[model samples]
Target chain A: MAELELSGVSKVYGAFNALRDVSLQIADGEFAVFVGPSGCGKSTLLRLIAGLDPVSGGRIAIGGNDMTARQAGQRPVAMVFQNYALYPHMSVFENIAFPLQMERRTKDDIKREVSRAAEIVQLSTRLQDRPAKLSGGQRQRVAIARAIVRKPGIFLMDEPLSNLDAALRMEMRAELTQLHRRLGSTMVYVTHDQLEAMTMADRIVVLNGGRVEQVGAPMELYHNPANLFVAGFIGSPPMNFAAARVDAVEGHAARLTVEGLGSFAVSYDGKEVSAGDAVTIGIRPEAMLPGAGEAGHLSFRMTPETVERLGLHTIVHAPVGAKTFTALFNGDPRMARGSALDVSVPLAQLHLFDRNGAGRSIRDIQ
Target chain B: MTFRSGAADAPAFNQNLGAYLFLAPALLILFLSLLLPAAATIGMSFTDISFLRPTNFVGLDNYLRLLSDGRFQQAVFNTSYYTLGVTLPTMVLGLLAAVALNRRFPFRVAFRTIFYLPVLTSLIAAAVVWVYIYEPYSGPMNGLLVSLGLPPQPWLQSPNLAMTALIIMAVWRDFGTAMIIYLAGLQDIPEEIYEAARLDGAGKFAILRRITVPMLSSVTFYLMIILIVQSFQVFGAIYVMTGGGPLGSTETIVFQMYQTAFGYTEFGYAAAMSTVLFFVILLFSIVGTKIMRKGEA
Candidate 1:
């Protein structure tokens, strides 16, 4: 295994930049995931690490050796594409043995290594079956087995699970985690699905518009996003943002007046703000409590627009003033549309963003 | 509203019938143009019909005669040579041209249009042009040879060179269709497959042999069937350029059939020859399909 690093990487296609000044590092035996929305350059970053694409500018190193100018085959990395591009004409065994054959390995060694990879992927019984004859999951396994048989220092996966159905995707996720642990290779995985990144990655790198917005553990990103983009992108049902104005700025404590909820004092540490300066108050769906009336509670009346009962919990789509947002409840609320109730945004779970969308620390406020 | 309303469904059912009725004329025209003549040919092959008389009930007489006729035997040999000569080279040349054109280059569209110009031109016109180009003394081909200090020989007038001339013209005229088909097949291959192959340490030739050729079998099978069928039916070029001349060296089956029917007015025999040609084409198509299917399996 090798530690992979990218410094000041960028990719430009004609006049458009596909990836802008990006830098990241994956320690040996670490599973780092690049997660973002479509066209966010997550997959482009993965391709750069695999050497499938040349960087317009930057240096890439593997095991402390410069590999920026090397060809994909010359690099010590293997990749599993999203489509599982197994040769349709080759049998499962041949697909797994292709890299070894390309390297001019002996026939006996190719067979032994192919069989070992098949065993690891639990595809021993399908050695002779062609890719067309295999199931979707089996074809995916063949793709994985093809990558693993090479035993490269780094494993690169580009949204490999996005093609599978939900249950199969879950199964493959678990299998991939086990495979990573057993192989102990430095793996760089790319996916637009935040759930997959949260569940599998040792560190999650959130990207937006070809730039790395934040990099941290899953919960760290969830609870303490560095900016508005990461805060809105890293969670399910997304965070709710409401326009607010600074009502008062006293020492490190500031009194913010939300559009619908009147005024509430939020602890924030940043440059002193004018009374009419606009800011945004962020709160996750799970942090909003129903029917909590207290001073500085940030309470507002919401008319339940829709109720989605999801067995273990209920999701209430409610309209507060002019905007509609979702709030997750632990039990069935037995609530119907058009019902009115008061919801409170807990100050501890609340996040305050300046006009530039950068987070302001609450401790600095006091 | 009731779920089963009879009045509401009547117009919808009648519209369906009216649609089928409107399609009758075109369907009838197609059947009359193609299927009727095919059925007549099959029935006429069973009789012995001379040009000026009623066809007599001669069971398998034409078939028997064809077995011993030296000219018919020569025609079969000539047709086989022409088919194999044209099909294999055209396929290879077409594949090469397609691979070259698949890359980006200046004026690519213009080049593609120029290469495919022969396919769009009428075959009779192309053959007429080629006939002049193959003239023995002053043609460009002979002039080039004379300029190069090589002996200028009779091209279409020589039995040995007549068939070679026809094969070359056929390849030139027909390779565009095959090239277009191959281009489509090459485009259908996903870009990621090539990327994966490259990352697997495969060089260009290995990728072409192991990835491209295997992936292109289905297109190859299709092109081969069309080329073989067209090769056997090669009449316009042979008629316009060679006229089956130079001791009948270029007398293919279709050319012979045309001569028997029109030049000699031997209608029944000509129909019998047409029947034989049809069966030969069918045999090739069936055998080719079976081989391709077996390879796939």
Candidate 2:
């Protein structure tokens, strides 16, 4: 296994910058995920590392070797495409044996290695069948079988499970994680699904507008998102942001008053803040449980627009004046549409952002 | 045929009558142009239907004569040679051109249009142009050969070279068709397959062989059948440039049949030849279609 380092890596397509000066280091055997929204340059960065596309600037090193100029085949990397991309004409045995055959191994060696890979993928019985005869999951196994047979230092998976149904995607997600653990190979997975990133990644590199927003463990990113974009992009029923003004500053505390929400006492680090300074306040949907509360808490009065009862959880979409956001609570079937409710956000769980979208949490300030 | 309006959920008489009226025009044309001639040809093959003589039913006389007909055998041999010669080279050239032009580059459209121009040109016009190019002394082909320090040789005049020369010209004229069809086939292959192949350590030639060629198999079979059938009816170029040649080396089945029916008025023998050629083409088509379907399976 080898560490992969991309320093100041960038990609430009004519006037558009797909990725700009983005750098990341994936340690050996780390399950690193590049997660972002659509058009957020996650796939572009993976393609650059895979050598499928050229980087317009900067360097890529694999195991501390300069692999920036290496062709895809010359690099110690194997990729599993999003579509599986199994050779439709070849049988499963040959599909897994392709890279070995390319290296011109002996016939016995090829047969032995291919069977071993097939057995690992639980595809031993279907080795004689062509890819067209296999189901989607089995075909993906063949693609995986093909990749692992080469024993490459890194496995580049680009949304490999996205083509499957939801149940199958979950199953494959767990299987891929197990595979990574068993093989101990560095895998750089890319996806737009935040849930997948949270569940699978050892460390996630959140990308936005071709720039690195944050790189941290799943819990770290969830608990402390560095900026407004990460805070909104990382979690389901994302943290809410509302306009607030500093009403008073006394010693090490600041009392911020939101327009429709009530005032909250936030810990003030030694930063210059006077009255009427504009700031954006963030509170997660889970933090806003339906309750009655007092100080050290931020209050919100919302009118429910829609309610979704998902058996285990209930999501209430509400409007606080002009801002529309959703709140999650235990499945409360009695929650009705158009109902007015007051939910309190605990002050310690609240997040604050200045006008420039840079984040500030109470832990850093206190 | 019985038309009953009494079957379960059958259409009423008026709707059925209207449907027949809607389909009658096309059916009438199909019967007149296709069915009638095919039936008549089968019938006439069993009898002597020469206009110069009273018709007589001769069941197996022409068939028995065809068993020993030397010139007809020679025509069959020449046609088979020309078919093989034309079909293979045309597909190879067409596939090469299609692959070369598949990627984006400056003037790609212009190059594609240039390659496709010969397919749109009239057959007689193209043949005439080829004839001039194959001209012994004045042609650019021999002129270039001489300038390259090689002796100028007759292109379409030599008996041994005439059929080969015709085959080359036919490949040049018709590979454009193969190119167009192969281009459409090439677009259907997903880009990820090639990327996967490359990651599998397949170099340029291996990707072409292992991915591109296998992916385009059905298209290759289709073009092969088309070129085989078209070349089996090869008459225009032979008539224009070779006229069955100095030693009848370029004489094909259709060209020989044409000479027998029109030039010699041997209508009975020519009809027999036409019937044999029809079965030969039918056999090739059936075999090709079966193989293609098997490949699909």
Number of the top-ranking candidate, with lDDT as the measure: 2
True contact recovery of candidate 1: 0.76
lDDT string, candidate 2, A1-366, tens digits: 899999999999999999999988999999999999999999999889988888999999999999999888888999999999988888999899999999999999999999998988999999999998998999999999999999999999998988999999999999999999999999999999999999999999999999999999998999888778888998998888888888988887788887677666787563756677787777788888786568766666788899888889999988885688788988674668887887887777877776644554433412
Off by over 4 Å in 2: A268-273, A357-366, B1-23
The clash tally of candidate 2 reads: 0
Looking at model 2, residue B285 earns an lDDT score of 94
**Model 2 lDDT per residue over B57-157, tens place:** 99978878888989888999999999999999899999999999999999999999999998889889999998899899899889989999999878888
Task: Tell me the lDDT of model 2 at B150.
Answer: 97
- Compute each candidate's TM-score over C-alphas: 0.93, 0.95
- Which runs in model 1 stand beyond 4 Å of their true positions? A271-276, A293-301, A333-336, A357-366, B1-23, B146-150, B289-297
Q: Which residue pairs collide in model 1, if any?
A: A268-A365
Give per-residue lDDT, candidate 2, residue B25.
100
